[model samples]
Target: MFRRTFWFTTGVATGVWATTKVNRKLKQLTPENLAVAAANKAIEAGGRLRDRAVDFALEVRDNMARREAELGDALGLNAPVDRALPPPRGYAVIENRNSPKYVEGPGQKSTYTTYPYNRNEDH
Candidate 1:
């Protein structure tokens, strides 16, 4: 009789342990639970991407301002125009036209070519 009771107790404990483990595993594998986890992961990834894009944009703006200042200095302009220029007041005009024709002076060789070159080439 004692042996029967011991076996019964052991079986109940084993069943309870198995049930808890299966429940835990099922919760982990459920589609709704996985979807929520995936959404959280996507949100984290998007936040990182946004931060990188902002950093890249700021870097590009800074470089453009530096280059504009350098060009103004080389041209002997009295005041730096970029620093003084305000943001466009109205809808921005898109000037998509090609560059103006190069005019050569007397006794100057025509070195103009249609191929693109860096802006510093003129300096």
Candidate 2:
């Protein structure tokens, strides 16, 4: 009787332990848990992409501004005209199709205007 009781108790303990482990595994494998994980990952990726795009746009704007300033200096253009007064000492004012163009003179503007170089030139 004693041996039978001990065997029965051992069997019950083993069954309970196995059942608990299976339940935990099932919880982990549920569709809800997997979907939540995928959504979190997608949000993280989208945030990173947005940050990169913003940074790229800012960099492009800065470079364009710098290039514009350099071109103005190279063309010997005076500072952009003030609507209130005539252009400064060396600057000539020009009317632009889309925007008002201010410069030293038409002569300098045409002189410095660059044409596209040979496109197929051998390196």
Candidate 3:
């Protein structure tokens, strides 16, 4: 009667819903779907790694340039060289390699260590 028809319809709907859910799960488990998912994830990871590597290289280059300039200034390497003569007025090298090497004239009094000490020291 009416109750029987209602139960029959309910059972059919439930069966159809279960079938659709199982078919969707099976599609996800298939080799093609899994491979596509893995490939997408790998591509995403590679892109992230590449970006990080590029950032690190750029940082290293910047710091290296900065350090090179600092060294050039310390060692007097940035100064223009005059190949002709040993001029009376110029930069002088101190005993310490870490110190700044510059002087305007022989008459100037400065903290730089020079010739007097080298003459006094026993070689």
User: How good is model 2 by TM-score?
Assistant: 0.45
TM per prediction: 0.48, 0.45, 0.53
**Residue 13 of model 3, lDDT score:** 100
Using TM-score, give the best candidate's number: 3
Off by over 4 Å in 3: 1-15, 80-123
- Per-residue error (Å), model 1, residue 8: 9.9
Q: Write the per-residue lDDT of candidate 1 for residues 1-123, one digit (tens) a residue.
A: 999999999999999999999999999889999999999999999999999999999999999999988998888874645766687788664432343434455898533445475665443
Cα error, residue 48 of model 2, in Å, equals 0.7
lDDT of 2 by residue, 64-121 (tens): 9999989989997757775797666885655443322223565565223333674533
Per-residue C-alpha lDDT of model 3 across residues 1-123, encoded as one tens digit per residue: 999999999999999999999999999999999999999999999999999999999999999999999999999998988889776887664364444443445676545545543443432
The predicted structure with the larger TM-score, 1 or 2, is: 1
Clashing residue pairs in candidate 2 (N, C-alpha, C atoms within 3 angstroms)? 92-103, 92-104
Model 2 alpha-carbon drift over 4 Å, by segment: 1-25, 78-123
Scored by Cα lDDT, where does model 1 land? Answer: 0.80
Which 10-residue window in model 1 sums to the lowest lDDT?
94-103
| Winner by lDDT | 3
